[model samples]
Target: MTQTLEQIASCISGYDPNALPVAQAQEFIARLVPKVQAVERVAIRSALGRVLARDLISGIDVPSHDNSAMDGFALRGMDLADDGPTLLAVAGTGLAGQQFTGPVPPGHCVRIMTGAVMPDGLDTVIPQEFTTLNAEGLVSVPAGIVRTGDNRRLRGEDLARGDAALHAGRLLRPADLGLLASLGQAEVAVFRRLRVAFFSTGDELRSIGEPLGEGEVYDSNRYTIWAMLTRLGVDVLDLGVVRDDPQALREAFTRAAACADAVITSGGVSVGEADHTKRIMAELGEVLFWKIAMRPGRPMAIGKICEPGNAGREAILFGLPGNPVAVMVTFYAFVRDALLAMSGATAEALPPLQAVCTTGLRKKAGRTEYQRGIVSRGPDGRWQVEITGSQGSGILRSMSQANGLVVLHHGQGHVAAGDLVEVLPFDGLT
Candidate 1:
């Protein structure tokens, strides 16, 4: 017999986000599961959002050699006197990407532009604005006493040779690409996107573009889940809407297990006349656990499914609730962390934020609650959150208007208007 929602949640409460203790899950998965096997060497132009497969070390010093950091005159520091104006001849001019080959003679200076390599035997640079240039190629510096290394970029100032620029298992951002380009790296090894297969199951569900039949509604959970998966950069294989047939659900689960790293389905996991996802999951693979003491998403299920040919490999399986909001919340709370772990990301459990409640809220004490609330800046410049009109699982409009979730713990009851509560910001997720 299936356990009650409260019983099931109690059994898993002590477990970490990976559904196991932190150290245990880390050790177990590290030994059993392989690192993302597929790696692609793509050009830096196309490496965004891809995980780095190896540490990037600088092959040579950045800026390679000493150069000028500003448009100025390059001369020996001793050439500038403390009180009197020192008049020197301008031997040559150096611009960006061009160098003055000749050495600096005594009482002589070279007009150097920004990013130009400093000429040999010259260490100090005075801005052209601070000096006067005569038509006869003579330069006069007034009260110019400069340091030896002033306005000069030393070799390897930005990055030294053999220094680790970026570590492995890091997701590449736009700025990361630019850093790679600065190091003259045209190609990088990155892990391939994880392929995820997902769907929704219910006899009352109907696909879009079809006529509305009696007692049928369009499947919105499938589209919403797909959008969320896309936002995470997962390669999604949408298995479409599956009816409440045991054989059909079984076949779809088998197909998904064969092709995807993880499979997600909404509905058909709760106790009902048409619920068959839990049964099929039991027959195909081990159902680790099901249900949780949480409103809206009590019938959540987590397990693994064995593929057809690959008997050893198992794909993760998650069964969410039928309510649209329940499905969305459960995906972010449970499945997102698991997927991030599989992608070699350093997964951290999100901590709830404290916010003052602007309105009184009512709830029972035995189950945890994720009430959608609107967060606004209080007159005191602190965040104040208030629950929306309704807390029903089917209220999708409330989710849109809500900016965060006011979390009520399992043992807590009603909260007074001015009491403090932990709120998870919705902007961080969707």
Candidate 2:
């Protein structure tokens, strides 16, 4: 049975919607979403960036035999003398893909190349660079240079037969595809792509190519959100912008929930704004309006939205703030990980990089702050960060000029010059 939003929140400690901490809000969202279960079989070549639906087991041992790791002479380790070099006759050469057909006596060695199978009864290899061929057919081996099992790659050393190679919920990368191909697997099962429908709200917003009237600006949140979602490898449905009217919001919310796994919107989530969007969200499903203890983004909504008169058909809803910079900060702080979880991918924690602050920053202790900053290596060979010109939430150009966000955590006060701080980089996330 599915649990209600209130019930889930009741299980958490200090579940305050109005003054929720950043960590607690993240925990709440992590528990709210469910992983997608639909699976499809596709060729390994086409499985990059898709989540694995099941565990992959190896059917055969890698290498299939003990092979040479370098071009050397394969021989018995005991044949070398204790104090000086030992000489042995060079038998037939052992090239890769062709076995040595001739038999060898106790004082004989085989000339071997890299990747060649180790001849029977030989357990060591002396690299060709470490030895020299004498005037006769004898190959000279140095004493105490190599021991038994030197430069030999044993069978099943990489991956053994019947061992689990990849686990479920793994986001397959290029290396994973190569591993699957090495195991002779041509096809793999992966979770189907996640569908996300997103749009912008407010009467002051206009789409691109449309003439803007007085007090109106083109919507930039949708483009930023779309770019972020595209990097996560999800199927995006661009719903465009919906007005602030009740009827328009109702139609947009209904259609988004009906066709997508999650619905995302910007604007009309704050307390002072019009309540049409909030009322419609509550009417459709259980919604929670949160004033999360974070900067640039404070007023936000998180809940499940259902199609009209159909409770069984619903999608997760994330109503973000209206400001351009706030939209991006909130999405990275909350929405990015939630969508990855819902897509059946394993949760990967991105460890923030610590850098020395170049200047002092004034901050309060109650709320978390994400300041756009340019992080680079200083002349002293240390990672240093400085905030972009203005830290206002509406200044989108500062965010574009930044390479990372200087994260000032809650319970932390003002920072002085040369203080170490955490930075969430934009390399992979952007």
Candidate 3:
């Protein structure tokens, strides 16, 4: 059974929309989103960045036969002399594909190249550089050089038959493709790509190449949202900008919810904004407006939006703030992981790195702050970070200049120079 927003909120120990903490908000969103159930089978080459639908099992053992790991001489371990050099006759040469069939004498060795099948009687290998070939048809093995079974690869060492090679919910990477090929798997079952519809609101917003008269600005939130969604491999539907009119906002919301699995809108979620986006959101579905305890991104709305006249069609809604920096900060903080979970992929949290702060920062004790920072290696070869100047929510240039965000927890207060803080780098965070 599908749970309503009230039912989900009732399960939490302390559910307060007015003063929600970052961790609590994350948990609430995680619980609210549902995974997409659609799956598709595609070739291994086309499965990159898609979540696996089931575990992939190996059908055959890797390295089916015992082989030589290096270019060396294959010999029996019992024939090595402990006190002095032992001489042996060269029986035959063993190439990679061509095996040496022999019934050699007791004191004999086979010259083998890398990846060549080991002879039936040989139990050890001495690297080619560790031995000397005399003028006669014999090789000299020095004492105390190698032990028994030194450089021979065992069969089924990498992957045994019927073993699980990859698990479900794994986002396939380039290396996973190679592993699939090694298992002789030509096609794989993966979750379908998530579909998301997003748009920005406000009468002051204008599209690119349009005239910005008096108090109008180009719509930047759409482009940024599109870029972020593209990095996650989701199919995006750009709905352009919706004006503050009630009818237009309603039509936009209804259309977006009808077509996409999730709907994202930026602007008009604040307390006293002159717009109908927030009203339309509430009128269309069960939405919860939040004032989360965080810096740069405080006002947000989250819930499920249902299309008008179509009760079966619904989409998850994430109403973000209007500022340029707040949209990005909130998206990375909340929406990214939520969408990954909805796509049926494992949403692994981005690990934070601890770095020394080079300057002091003033922070409140009750709110978590995400300060734009430039993290670098100090002169002492330790990780250190410095904040970018002017961290206002409207200033996006500081974010562009920063490579990371200094995450100060809700309980933390003032920070001085040389203090250690956690930073989330922008490397893998498109």
Candidate 4:
């Protein structure tokens, strides 16, 4: 028997994002979730933005040998005495990519450049400006300075052999590529990008570049969601726009389940005459929950799709609200964490900061609110957030001008101008 939305939510101890709290939502997803298993090996140069499948251990020392950290002269530390002028003959010059052969004799120094290997028997380096070159090819070092191992970079100072350079589940970045290259790692093993299917459903929504018919608007949610997914490093399978018909919704759901690891759609989940997504999802997969007690995104559906003739894999299904702002907020609030879990990322929540409210805000109790606000550093060097002009979910311009989401907890009524609030920065998707 298929479980209803509420029943399914109850079966999972912490499935309700609102009532169960944000921390619990994170814990439940982390505990009950398993990341995708497909892995791929690619060159380190091409592995940027890919999730690591295994730990990367260093095969050799980072510098490979002891090298000079400055352009100076290399000599024995005890050769110079305090307040005494010590003279030494210049033996050879060492530049990058070249090493000085043989050891430096007792009254001799080597002219070494930065990144050049320290010559044998040389224990210290003095800057070229500190030494005087005589016409007889002799170097003079001032006395009273007894420094050992100065301006020398030891072998493996950055990374040593057998040390783990990167751990599993880490997302590769540009700096990571340079680090891997320094360790001579030509290839890296990483998890393949998760394939996600997205679509927008509504009789009143039309794609861009199409003439608007009577009572129809452009399908802005699809493109918005696609951009967010692209920032998340997901391979998007765009299914185009689907009408609010049960048969069409069912067909799209089936195809999505067969091909995508997850499916996301905006609109057609609420209780209305043309909302057939809920009913069609019931026929295809079990609907987990709907109607969270949150502003702008109250009507949401979460489920797992079960398809015929395919090995059963839990395919996440999210039915976001129809409003443009609601769709954007809900995607960050709920879907982003789930997708990160699917990608094997442990930290799910967005980076948050504390900011002071610059204006009084009014709100009703018993429902959580995500108000768009502009955050900027005040003259006092403190962060101050102010709500935008409008708070309507249909106002897309408000989101455009906002820098972060000011969160109002449930049961909190109104906030004063100086009250502190938690702010989630809007630096784009993840």
Candidate 5:
């Protein structure tokens, strides 16, 4: 259902614009983002990493016939009565893709290979290893060895016919391809990939390969945002760095809103008299500047931007903080999931793994904090997390040295050494 901004905000109890809780901010974004309705039919191999537009129902039963699970003899359960070394005649052989025509006579068994259909009136199988065969073409089973219905695969055991095997809103994985193939699906429908436009906003930020002045720093946030967005399988449009001028920022926002489904801008969202980035964003659309109760990414903005001259040409906007580390932190914490939802992908949280902290840490309550961590196995073969030096928002090197983010909850307090904390590894993000 489509909800207005006010309608979505009313759902949250005691909603505060200035001091938004981390969870509340996430919830607000979830309720506001709209899913893409465009879909395309592609081969199973091309469907990997694409969001499934609809459930893929199984038209036929998997393993449509009852077959043997192993190379064994197929015999009636009554043939093993009393388990006293029963003797049976080896009737014939049943190989895969070949079924025996005539039914087995009483006390007669059929030699069945793996995946071969069971012969008529045969309900049990004794593995060849367990049975001894003589040169006279007779097989003998030990007493109380084989049970009834052992090593037989029933029809449609893996998947039933006319059942929904795969659900909608699922991001297809490698295993999903093999599963759809088992269902005899040649092509599957999936959502279209999202197009995202991103840019950095700051007069002091210089682009790479350009001459850097003594007071200017190279623009690294755009590059980092580009990499993160690309990993999510979206077509990214890098708009480079928009200067501090209001007119220049406005023109860039207009172009981005008209062409892309989502617009991501780093820097100029925070309070700064030298930049009019937030003011221009507010003029473009319904922009909500949020001081989210989260460390390293507190001052941010979220809203939708519409093209100046074109009606209904709008895009979701994320105005992230200027700091390199903060840009990444905010993107991973908020924007990543929102983009996934917008692209019709399922909303799945990255689960945090518990790891022992190697050093003491200071953190205040009432706000969540994400500290870059080096997660690795200690000498004791147990997972532990070590905080990178200088947890400053501008220290991008710390993020480079870390493989995980040590998450301190909104209500969490100071952590001591050897304390178990939640760490989200980068490899776990999908």
Candidate 6:
């Protein structure tokens, strides 16, 4: 997967790596992420939530011995009556983790418990519920009720020896911990956490607790990005807000480049008459300003920056939209996966779920639209979605109020009520 930017850029059909499409941008970011090569072995108990560095191979077969899958009588299938009912004397008991080693007579059966190893020379089992006990202390086997191997658990039934138990790049979950414990793994190899830095910029933007001057709004994008990055388990550095001045921005970018792996700014990439951030960004490194065919986050700039004190090292630069909602949309749509890649994670596609639209949606065919929506089960017990009150880029509440984002593709037309559309849920869908 080692690909130069040109090699990746060539895969796009129309091939404007500049005005990159959404899917192409996704691929480019995935290919460009320098997955952490450094690996450290941590105890399995401490490995939960960390990405595995290599495939986990099972050293031994699961259920290392042949065992019973149910509480039943263990007997040889050959000893069963082919057409008529049969009866056998209960000679012994086989409890779980215990064994029955006595030599049984021809007409004797072993009472076995679930998880107990099958008695020697036995191949079939009939549950105690299926057998009738008589005055003679014999168990009745109903005609045609039991089959050979019906309650037998073969050795290696759960997992075969030398099989790959878990693939690399997986974010270890609770079940993964159990699997590691089963495999007798005391420690696991994992990738190092990524280092990410973000900042907010706008002359009209004011940090919270500042004076409420005319034409000033609080800077909340930094907080949102901080929460999002923290959830990714990356080390985040908050660079605060940089004013519109070039010198102030230059110093911030320089310091950020030297200290962080990537720098994200929530503003100064649009086609407005007052955007000086792109110029300063280009002055420091190679950048591509794009008008992606997408809604709420059409204007974006991405590239690499090298500062003087960094000794020729470079850090990724993401110049996101200033609008509150647009910043979130672009981050979820783009930055999230890129950061995951940089952190040595595999590219995981967030597939959208099909849900009936409760309200109508009008969209053009040339651009992708991520309209906030509330997804829930309707009275019909079917999942449906409705757009939030306002999808304005500046209205952050639209995202806060909604539980999912309705993904309208570039080739899709206006959607009518009751029409099925694809939705990316905010919870669990990740």
Instruction: Provide the TM-score for each candidate, comma-separated.
Output: 0.79, 0.96, 0.95, 0.89, 0.94, 0.92
Candidate 6 lDDT trough over 10 residues, lowest sum: 1-10
- The residue-by-residue lDDT of candidate 2 on 1-430, one tens digit each, is 7778998899889899999989888999998987888999999988988999999999999878898998989998878788999898988799999877688789899999999988888888989999988899689888888988899999999999988999998989889999999999999999999999999999999999999999999999999999999988999999899998888999999999999999999999998898999999998888999999999999999999998878798799999999999999999999999998999988887779999999999999989999999999999999999999789899999999999999999999999999999999999572
Q: Tell me model 6's lDDT, rounded to 2 decimals.
A: 0.85
User: Per-residue CA lDDT of candidate 5, range 1-430, in tens?
Assistant: 4566788889988789788889999999998888888999999988888899998888888788888998989888888968378789988899999998676899899999999988878988889899997778689888888788888888898888988898999989899999998887899999999999999988898888999888999999988898898888888999999999988998899989988999999988777635588888889998788899999999988888998887577799999998999998999899999999999988888998999999999999999999999999988888999998899999999999999999999999999999999999988765
What CA root-mean-square deviation does each model show from the true structure?
A: 5.4, 1.5, 1.7, 3.2, 1.9, 2.3
Any runs in candidate 2 off by more than 4 Å, and if so which? none
lDDT of each: 0.79, 0.92, 0.92, 0.81, 0.89, 0.85
> In candidate 1, how many Å is residue 358 off?
5.0
Query: Model 2, 266: alpha-carbon shift in Å?
Result: 1.2
- Report the C-alpha lDDT of model 4 over 242-276, residue by residue, as the tens digit: 99888888889999988888999898876674647
Would you list the clashing residue pairs of candidate 5?
Answer: none
Clashes of each: 0, 0, 0, 5, 0, 0
Candidate 5's C-alpha runs over 4 A off are: none
Pairs clashing within candidate 4:
81-144, 82-143, 82-144, 83-143, 83-144
- Per-residue CA lDDT of model 3 for 28-84, tens digit only, reads 999999999999999999999899999988899887778899999999999999999
